[model samples]
Each structure stands twice: as structure tokens, then as C-alpha cells.
Target: MQNLQSFASAMSRRLLREAGNLPALSGNDFASSKEIQRPLDVLSQGSGSFSAFPKSNEQITTPSLPESAENVNAANQLSAPVTQSADKESSGSKYSNWIFVLIFPAAILLILVPILVCRKRGNASMGPWRTGLSGQLQKAFVTGVPKLNRPELEAACEDFSNILNTFPTCTVFKGTLSSGVEICVVSTSISSIKDWPRSAETLFRKKIDTLSRVNHKNFVNLIGYCIENQPFMRMMVFEYAPNGTLSDHLHVKVYEHLDWAARMRIIMGMAYCLQYMHHELDPPVAVNDMRSDAIFLTDDYAAKIADVGVWKELADKAKATKEDGSSRSVSPPDLAGNVFCFGALLIEIISGKLPETNDPDCICIWAEEHLKAKSYSTLVDTSLQDHQADELEAICEVIQGCTDPDPMQRPQMRDVTSKLKAILAITPEGAGPRLSPLWWAELELLSMKSN
Candidate 1:
């Protein structure tokens, strides 16, 4: 009995010391005195008088009482399992807390990252792209682009009365409405594709959107559009350009000679139109096809741009490369490409011949050859009587800047507009270069010799 009491007293003291020394788990340690006492107290229940301990056998102590010994033995048996279970629970809680602290934030981040990325991509693809132009236009398709009723448009078109021009993708018709409004109708040809009517509707809808937003006297207005069944035709209506294309006047010689001042006026007007479309509109419009054929002339020699449409690159399975030597998935050229097209236009205006007369590469070279030699007279058309070297050079500067190979070096549309405006301000209407005092003196000398 003395030995058992001595053993219990020593073991309890050892357990208290050891509890203080158990290392931290996941940077959190159990407090020593309070925690140690809790488990030890539970373990020592019914083990009476732990404060008192019997000495060694030399003290001549009598045997311990039966009741006390039984209680001590029972408590000793229970203490081991209780202490073990408590230690296991403490270790398990620490491990669970450590795992949550490490993993919870990472799990949240993994979930949020993909969501943010998907939202950004979705907005870019589906929403209207913001532009540098005026903020009035948000979406490309605004409320003004209407979807006309099929029957009413057919009735107005006089049931496809006259064919104006035919094309592979669409057909043009000269339609005279009961209201006496003459409209040019371009109807899509949906015969070749699997389900092109649906796709063509998408195409025409975009066209309607493009035309509706364009507001200018120089631009051919889109009056209305028709999407009809029975024939399944999707057509857009534009106000007729009265005098036909500028190609007829310059190339075909249908009209009388256009003077230098008139030609410059036409060119300046065209530049202003381009500036409005490129800089003033939100999400700028780029017209890929700019040529003499694409410009229209009115009775008073007013120039209006025609056949304006967006060019998009699409993948073609049948052809390895396009006729223009571009990619299969064809998209519109950037702003610099548009500027290059303007350069080509300027070359046509100055030379009074088509860019196609020479090789596409040689066109710029031809201009450079003429300009560098100071042979300015050759730049003017045989039809034009007025010619000025200084004026032509000033106009040529803008053209040269636009056609530069490095896109970054090219002048912006706004800059081009400003430059042309300055030229117009200095130039007189209905006039040629003023005669100098040197020319008058030479004329006097010639008159004296004749006398």
C-alpha cells in the first residue's frame, strides 16, 4: 500500500511537469497551469487525499484501509483512459484548425479568380466597344436602326420593280415608293449557303446599324430597310445619289471639265467626311473601299461618298489565301490602313488617273518621282487650267505623311483635317496663282521690243 501511494504521487508530479513541456502545434500552445490542472483533476477524482503520501517501509506503517485502497485502485484504472482520450482530442482540434487556416483563403481565391476573368471576357465580346470619338453613341446599334414590316416595304418597293445592279452576295433595285421617294434597294442573295437567310439577316442588321448612325449631307442616307419572306429578301434602302458616281466625271468623261478650285473643294469635303466618321463618332467607322467609283457627284459638283461598308475577314475553307493575299480569317484593317487608302485617293485626285494604271506598289513611287523633280505642272490634269506648285506641294505633304510605311509616323485624321482647313483658308475661290511683279516687268520688256 505504501509503495502504491508513493508511485501515484510521483506519477502525478511527473505528468504536471511534462504537460508544461509539450510543444506548440501550428504556432498555438495550450496554456500550462490551467490546462494541466483540468485533465489531472478529472483523472484524480475519487483517488482520496493526493496531498498526503506514506513514507518508505522503514516507518513501520500498518497496511492501508480496504475502502481507501479500493477507491484508489478504481481511480487509477480510470485515469489512464481519460488522460489518453483528452490528449487525442486536443491534438485533433489543433490539426483541424491548422488545415482550415491554410486552405480556406486559397479555396476562396481559386473560386473568385475564374469568375472575374470570365466576366471581363464576356463584356469585351458581347458589349459595345468604347472609342475615342464623342460619347453620345454607346452601342453600334442604337434605337434609330429600325426593323421594318415585310409587307409594307414590299408594297413600297413596288414588288421589285426594276433591277439597278447585280452582285454575287446581293442585288440592287431601283424602287420608287408611292410617296415619290426614290430609294436604292440592296437585297441579299441567300441561294448558295446552308442557312444564309438567318446569317444574312445578321449582316443586314449590322449594315442598318452602320447607316442609321451616319448623319451627314455628304453621306447617302439610309431611309428604311425590308426583311421579307415568300421571297426571303433582306434589303436596305438608300436615298438615290442624283448624278451617279464620280468615276463617270473623272475617268469616263461624262461631265465637262472640273476646275482646280472645284476639285479641291470636293477633296476637302471628302476629308471632312472622313474626319467626322473617324474621330467624331464613338467607336470610329473604317470604310475599306475608297476610290473614284465609290464617290458620287450631285448637279452642282457636290461630292458624296457612296458604297461605304465595313470589311470583315472570314475563314474560307475552299481557298488557301484570298485574292488580296490576306489571311483566311479576314478582318477590317486598322486605322492606319484607312489612312493609306486616303493616300491612294489623294494620288488619284492629283494625277487624274486611276491607281490601277500602274502596279499597286508603283503608285506611291510615281508620286514621289514627280514631286522630287519639281515638275509640278505634270501633277495637274490636262483638263484643269489652274495650277500652283506651292499649293500642290502643301497638299502633297499630308498625302506623304499618310502613306508612310511606319503607322506610328502617319498623321491622324484630325491632323489631316486641320492641315487641309489651313490650305483652304489661304486659297481663293475660282482663281489660279496670282502673277508676280517679275512677270509684269518681263511683259513690259516684251512690249517695248515689239514696238
Candidate 2:
């Protein structure tokens, strides 16, 4: 019985030592360790009903069986609390580890998702042609304007080997379709195309739609367009003008100097086209480009307006979008700007001066100075002498009104066309201006010379 008490006391002492040496996991664990240690101290001291340990020479007393059983029961009750506390501590540690494991990946996913989405969107915008034609070009297919492919364009342009003219923003290639019709292919280089903003593709499609709808004798006809992505090509095809640009006739002197009558006819053609655009169309299409080079001449010296179709691309090259690629605020139609450009073109035509040269002999400054002094003689082109004084005065008056300092004060294109018709002595019901009798004789002479 005494041996049993000593064994229980030694086991309690070992458990107390282990508990003291262990590190506490938390405040609750430390409190649990303290509560368990109190019972362990009572058992190790043998304070319940037995002496702690029997000495070698000291006498030992053996208790009754009931007393020994009671002592065993006390030891068991003390051990139960320690086992329960240990189980709780182990479970708590496992739960905390699980929480840490789950939270880390969730945080990483939150950070990565936005970055991936933004990258995908950027790539999609850069290659919008991957989705094929959507709004405008889809409807254009059934509207007489064909949607051409890269291979057909390549064959027509002779593998794009025939280059006609190269402008800063695009290249003009001369091509002949399978039907043996001549067409001009305007294409942008791949290097410069990379710099185009996201809105450039959208704007290009819209311009194609609008130009396809246009049907005017004085406007260049849009035949079809080609869109591709592998080599990144966007091209617009138009009817080839054989007589070349008005600038070529006037400034380059490749042909005979235009007489006063030829100039009037060219100006009248442009006016009629401008009137149609400004008054006839529902949402008026402005002549955004009015340079002399932009005007193509027919074999008969009639004017055909070109470059209006690709004005948006030309504008993008001049000015880029916002830094983040967002489009700028929408501006109202540029009808007033069109009126101003027409006035400048008129001055250029009359003075036979190139505004782009910006020389000391600039026509705009020269005309303004001469008109303020009412000096009509100096404003006429040096080559022109056959024009009557009254006719010259009427034309100068029109120029003055069109070039008014305030845009609001300028005459509408419709009014300008009416005044031009009146000056030509043609009624609205008349088919066209009566050809000058001398004009026919001169035409026959030129034809004979060419032959």
C-alpha cells in the first residue's frame, strides 16, 4: 500500500517537471497549465492520505484496501484535467494553421486577377481586326461597296510593287483589278500603324461607311476596302484619276497654263459639290481637306474632291489621343472651318499662289492688303488679262465675304454656289454654264497637239 503511494507520488513529480519545462502556446494554455499543476503539486506532496516517499531506514505503514483504492481514484481524477487541456491546445493550433493557409492564397488571387484582366483588354484593343467587321463594314457589303481580301488586293497591286505617291501618313499604290479597272490603294506602313490610337480602327470603318454612301459626280468613288491583321494592313480603294491633281496642273506646269474660263469651271464644280454636302446630306459631311493637292482634275479640267475619306487618319497622325488612349471630347461638325478653308482655296486659285510655301509673296496677305486699298489690278494672276473688270469685281466681292474675320459672318456654301451661278449668267434650271466659244477652239487645239 505504501509502495503504491510512492509510485503515484513519483509519477506526479515527473508530470509537474514536464509541465514546467514546456512552453505556453497562449494565455489560455498557460492558465490551463497552471490549473493542472496545482493538482500535480498536491499529488506529489502526498497531502491527500499517504506519506510522500518512504525513507530507507524509516518505518512504513500499509493502509487498508479501501484507503489504497481511494488514493488511486484521487490520482486518476487529477490526470483527467491535464489530458483534456492538452487535447484542446492541439486542436486550437491546427485551426490557426488552417486559417493562415487559406488566407494567403486568397490575397494573392485578389491581386493577380485585375492585372490579368487589364493585360487582356490591352491586347484585344491593339488587334481589333481579329473580331472582323461589326457595325459599318457589315452593312457596307450589301450596299454596292465590296469588302475585299488581302490576296485580291495583293494581286491587283502586283504584290504591292507599284508605288504611285508616298505621303507622310500613307502610301498610294496604283493597281488594276481583275476587271481591268484602275484603282488607287491607300495604305499605312506597319511601323507607323503601331502608333495609332485605339479609336483609329473605329474611325476608319465609319469613314468607309460614309464615303460609300456618297454619290456625287465631283467626288472620288470608293470601290472597296481591305482589312487584315497578320501583316496588319488597312487599305481603301478608289477610282484612279488619270488627269492628276489640280496642283499638278497649276503649280507643276505639266500642262498648259489654265485660262480664266477653265479656272471658273473648276471652281464651279467644287462649289456644287460643297453645296451638296452641306445642304443635301442629313448630317452634313464637311470638306475637312481643301488643299489644292487634294483636288483631282479630270481630262476636261473639272474638279473632283479627294482625301475627304481619309481625313480622320490624317488628323490622327497630326495629333494623338490622350495619354491613356481615351478619345478626346466630341466636337461639333466643322462646317464653319470648311467655309474658311474654301475661302482660302479661292484665294489660292485666283492669285495662283501656294499657301503651303508661306513665302513673302503669300497670297492671303497680298490679297488682304490689295483688297483693303480697293486695288483690283494687283490681285489678278499675272497670266490673266482676258477677264472683264465687272466680272473680276464680282468675284473679289465674293472672296471678301467668304473670308470674313468672323466665321459666323461667312456666307453659307449654298449662298456661295448661288452667287457663283449668277456670276456665270446661268439660271438654276440650266444644265450647266454655257461653254465659252473660245474654250472649244482651245480644247481642239490642245487635242491636236497631244495627237
Candidate 3:
């Protein structure tokens, strides 16, 4: 019994020792084993078409994904040079484009600048000669006027020492050339610059151009321009009218009252000038600055239009506002405005009064009323008591037509000239000494020429 009990105790001790020696796995261990095996299962069950990586590098066959990755990496490597070459080509093209853009405008400027300079040089002419003031004297010799040397002009104007008239924009000096020819020097008040008031230089050039083209006995001729550098003076020169402006004759008591024939002669001369300007010239010059101040008489009493279109240039500065409230450069007055201005002058010539300053009773209005009433005798100047009534009425009708408010209705300068010429033939000899001695001599000369 004791032996049997000892055997059972030994068996129990052995079972306990075996059980303690073995490591026991919980539910977590079982889960980890299944999770690890699942990925291996998926790899082993991949499509049969792809073979696994081979042992020998020479026979290394890649599966589908690895082969695609290798091909993509190879494509990137091969395309690098092509992309770099395209970038280089694009960069070169851009550089060429930049160079072209930079050079084109500079090329245009280089071409255009010289052409403009040559055109300017071409305009330089001296009476029957092509002379240019490119290097030293910047004088614009217009028409066939003689190119007065700077030294000669300096001598004439006494180096701008004397001021005949001090005006707003320029100072006028009476000058005499070495050859005894008289000239008036007009100098700007501003110092030497490209332009004054921005548009002044342009207007001055325009004036020069107008004067250059005009060639009439009744239009003041441009002598030349004196543009000096050191003692900078921009000047325009014109032949001196010793008798002064027409304003002097009509307004000043020092001058003798113009007789009826003399007055008619003045009006006729003005019409001749207008015809020359508006009809004769290829591009007709619109002489709007038609005031007594613009008219100058020669020693022989021939009236010449001076300072043509200058005052208009000065007054043209302000921009004109459109009806729609937009601003634009004010253009020169149309031909109608010019006609109206000439009509104002007619009032002065007929009435022997300064028509410009007559405020409340504008002589034009008074003349219009008189004409409507057939008051022809009243239109004649009171100074000339001895005049033919029939001839005077005819003259009044001409004045009325010229001074018409509607420019379209007014007779053209050519028509006006024809009418005045007819009047001259019918005009009877005046009772008194009709004209200045010089003018009578000129008339006789003209008659001789006609014969």
C-alpha cells in the first residue's frame, strides 16, 4: 500500500514539472500566427503569369509591378536629355526675340530722325539760292529773300540795342542792313528754347511757311529769320514800312485825312491781297487777323497785310469744349469768321472811324441799318465832301456784300476784286488833290504800263 501511494505522488510531481517547463500561448499568440501567415498566402497565390525574381542576375525575371517600375524609371532617365535640349532651344528662342524687340525701335528712330532733319534743311532757301543755316547761323531764309548775314543783321538792329515797339511776346526793333535796306527785327521775350507755350514754335514755323509761299504786292514779304546761338535771339524779319501801321493813318490826327479816291484805293489794295491769299495760293491762307494794326502802307501808299495770322495763333491756345463736354484743340477760324473780320475793317474804311473800339454803337451794325434804309450817302466819310453819288452808291453796295454776316452769301475775294476794278474805271477824278505825291506817281506809272 505504501509503495503504490509513493508511485502516485511521483507521477503527479512529474506531470507538474512537465507542465511548468512548457511555455503556454494565450488567444493573442494564436491571432499573431494567423496574421503573419496570411500575407505569405497572398504572395504565393499571385497570378501564375508572373515569375518570381531569379537567383542568377543574367536570368533575373521580374514580376509585373517591378517590371513596370523599372520601365518608368528608365523612361525618366532617357527623357532628361530631350527635356534639357528643348529648354535650351526655348531659352535661345526667347533670347533672340528679346534682342529683336530691343533693336527694332532704335532702328526706326535712327532712320526717322535724320529724314526729319533733311526735310528741314530742304526748306532753307535764300532769294534765288538754296542756302542752309545748319552749322552756325540758324536763320530760315524763306522764299527768295536774301540771307542777311548775322553780322549784317546785328548791324541793322544795332545788336538789338533799340526797341521800336515793345509787345507782349516779342520786341520789335527798327534795323537797317549795310545795303540801306530797312528791316524790322522781332525777338521773343523768352530765352532760347525749343518752343514757347508748347505750341508757339509750331505756330511760328507755320507763320514762316505762310510768309514763304506768299508773293503779292499787297502782302508783307518775309525777309529772313535770325536764330542766333551765343546771344540767343529767335527773330523774324520783315521789310520796314516807314509810314507805320494803317492804325496810324486812321486814328492819328498827325496824318492827313485820306480823300475818297485814296480810301477806295486802300480798300481795293486790301481786296487784291485777300484774293491773292484765298484764291491764288494753292492752299489758301486764311488771314483772320484782319485789323488796322495788320495793314502797313509803303511810301507810295500801297497797303500791305503785315503780321498775317499771328494774333490768331496767340488766341488759339485755349482748348475748345465740344457740345458733349469733351476738350479738343481749337482750330483756326473758318473762312466765314475771316469774312466777318474783314467786314469790321470795311466799317472803318467807309466811316473813317476806328471801328474796333466803338463799343455800344458798332459801326457794322450802324452801317447795316443805313444800307437797309438805302442811306448810301451816309456810308461815305465826311472828310470827302466832293464825291460822285452814283459811284459812291455802287461802292456802298460792294461794302455791304463783303460785310455780309453769312460767309457763304459773301462774294469771294476774286469776285470782290473784279467789282472794285470796275469801280476804279468809272470813278471820276476828285475835286481836291486826291492822293499823296508818291501814290499819284505810282498811278501814273501803272497807267503808262497799261497803255
Candidate 4:
């Protein structure tokens, strides 16, 4: 009994010393110490007094107790690292979140800054029109319509002071390129167009696109275009026609009078052009200004139409429509209007008189009456000689059909082309040798074949 008490006292003192050295105790440790004290106090009270140590040792004991302070200390040591590991994991997750938040925006800035730098550089090189004329127009200028440098064009056209002819909408300037090829530069003042300050690029792009697609021998060749700033200008470059316009030859007498064969060829070419524009092209093109003045003559008197698909009138019409709030979109060019004008052109060609000089409405009427009376001479140009009567009658018949007031009553250009071809076949060449002897010989052979 004495040995047991001594052993208990020594064990209790050692446990108390260790508990005092501990840095701090958790709530669980404090509660566990209290639980040990209840049993120890019960024993101490029951035994009438054991030795009291410090306050920490007072709460716990070892030797006589089955649940010892030493065992609780061992369990606390095992559990301490696990709680610290959970705290470390939580701190690591927070640190990773901060890194991600910082890195994402930095990555975005790295991507965006270079693009902005490149865009600034590009704007510096290409000028103000670069952004306005990007995408399809930029691609078109590169691949389809050659973009002539404005400075080079200015030098060629003598700073555009060498004017060839002036019209209400545009001015023509004759220039010889550096390569010694003669070119006609047509300049239209876009400054006059409504809302041009805002829509200059779009208007020019649309106009140039319309002009560029006309690929035919009978239409003036679109060589290139120029757009410049600081006294801004928009110009189209064309192959210069040495013989000038049909109006120059026929009305103004700038050149010698056209012979019967030449007139026939011009008529035939104009017919074919109408056919090509009105039927052959996917979306049929309409000529806004279909006058004799619009026709150019090559060195060989081959008729090539100028300003075939370009007009400021379209923009004006669109502006008018917009002002009235009548339409959000521009209406398509009136193909029937061209048909009516073509009839007037045919009348002008035959009579050698301006339809505008006579009653424009009555011009078709009188020409039709002359055709009906078989008075072909009255309808024929006084300048034209040796033209076949059948050819005149046939052409006047086409004019009558074209000039019908009702648009639906007018014949398609395809049909007009066919009729003109039939007339051309029957009519013999006058004043010039036949165009192709072999072709003519074949025609003669075919004529001999059937009724």
C-alpha cells in the first residue's frame, strides 16, 4: 500500500511538469483535463488527501487512473498535425485563386495590346479611308480593280488641269500614262453627294464596283481608279478613244460624217450592248444616261459606250426617297426606262436630229407614221446614203416596239437584238469593204441554202 502511493505521487508530478511546458491547449485538451480532474478529485477526497501540485497537474493524473493524461497527450500529438494540414490546404487554395485572378487579365492584355499596336501602324500607313474601305472593298481593290496611286494619276493628268470635256456630273481629262498609253480620266465630284462626308467610301465603292464589272469590247475599258484626300477626288481611268463620242461625230461634226456601213455597225453594236446588259448579266444592268453622247468611237469607228452603269442620279433618287421616308432601300435601276431611251436613240440615229429638239413624245409617233406610209426616205438621215429600205423599215419597227407607253408592251432587248441581227444579215455593207471576207462568204453560202 505504501509503495503504490509513492509511485502515484511520482507519476502525477511528471505529468504536471509536462503539462506546464505545453505552449497552449485546445478546447478539447481543456475539457479532457477537467474530465480527468473529476476522477482524481473523487479519489483525493475519498482518500482524505493526496499531494496537491500546480493548477495544471491538479486537473490531471496518471498512475491509478486507467485513462491517463499521458495517453490524452499522445492522442493530442496525433490530431494536431491533421488540423494544421487542413489549415495549410485552405491557405494554398486561396493563394492559387489570387494567382489566377492576376494572370487572366494579364494574358488578355498581352493578346489585345499587340493587335492595337498593329492597327495603329496600319492606319498610319494606309490613311483615313483604310478603316472605312476595309473588308470586301479592300479585297476588291487588291484583286479586281487596280488601285492607281493618286500622285501618279495627278502627274499623268497634269494635276487634272488638262480637261477634255465637261458634263454636269463629271469631267473627262485626257492623259498619257508613264507607259505612253493614252488614258481618259473621268472625275466626278463626290463632295456634292448628300451625306458624302459620312458615306464617301461607300458611295465610291458602289460606283466603282458597278463600272468595273462591265467587260465588253463595246464598253470603255476600266483600267483603274484613284481616290485622294486634301482636295479629295474620285477618278476612273479609261482607255482613251481617239475619235471621241458619237455625239461629236453626228451632231457637233467634230469628225467626218459617219457612212451608212459605220452607222449600221454602230447600231448593231449598241443593240448587242443593250442585250448583254439587259439579259446576259446575272443581275441586268440599266444605263442611266443612254444618250448618243455616252457612245465613244474607237480609231476604227467601233462604238464603245461610256458611263454604261454609273450615274449620280441614282444617289439623288435614293436621297429623295429617304427624305420622304418612302423606302429604306434604293429601288433597282429601271430597265424599261432604258428601253424607252434606246427607242429615242434609234430615232436620233435614223433621223440625224436630236430627239430633244423635236417633241420627245411625238418623235416616236412621227417616225412610226413614216414607217407605216412606207416613206422610208423621210425617216432616213440626210447624212446617210445608200442604206437599204428594208433595213430602215425593220429598225423603225423595233423603235415603235421599244417606245410603247406600257412597259409590258415593250420587247426585251434579247428580242430587239435578234431583230437587229436579221436586218444586218439582209443588208449589204455600204462605203466600206466587208468586215470578214470568210464570214461573208459563209453567209453567202448559207443564203443560197434555203427559202
lDDT of model 1 at residue 424?
Answer: 68
Ranking of models by lDDT = 4, 2, 3, 1
Task: Please give the lDDT score at residue 328 for candidate 1.
Answer: 34
lDDT of 1 by residue, 264-305 (tens): 777776777677778866667666566777677665666677
Residue 363 C-alpha lDDT in model 2 = 56
1-451: candidate 2 lDDT, tens digit per residue:
4554577677657654564554434446435653454333222323323334443366432222223454458756875775465556556755655676788789999999998996665443322212221122222333324567787778878999999988667788988755555677888753455655557766767677666555455666565777787777878877666678877777776666887777777778788778877887666777666778888876666677886436445446335663455575434458877776777777777777767662323555658877778787677778776766776676777778877778899999999889888876633223222221222222322232234
Whole-model alpha-carbon lDDT for candidate 4: 0.63
Mind giving the per-residue lDDT tens digits that candidate 3 earns over 183-270? 6777776565533343554555666666666655566656566556566556777756677777788778898667777667777777
The lDDT per prediction is 0.57, 0.63, 0.59, 0.63
Higher-ranked by TM-score: 2 or 3: 2
The clash count of every prediction, one per candidate, is 3, 0, 1, 0
Candidate 4 per-residue C-alpha lDDT over 1-451 given as tens digits, one digit per residue, 9 for 90 to 100: 3554586588658755755554432446546764664322221211112222344444634223236667567656764665466557656755766687789789999999999997775544333223122222222343234566677677778987999877666678887655555778887744443434334355557666665555555666565677666566777777666777887788876678987777878887777777777876656677777778888887778777777335365445445555664433435868888888888888888788765652356577767777667777787788776788778888878888899889999999889878988877622122112221222222222232221
- Residue 185 of model 1 has an lDDT of 68
Report the Cα lDDT for candidate 2.
0.63
Decide which is better by TM-score, 1 or 2: 2
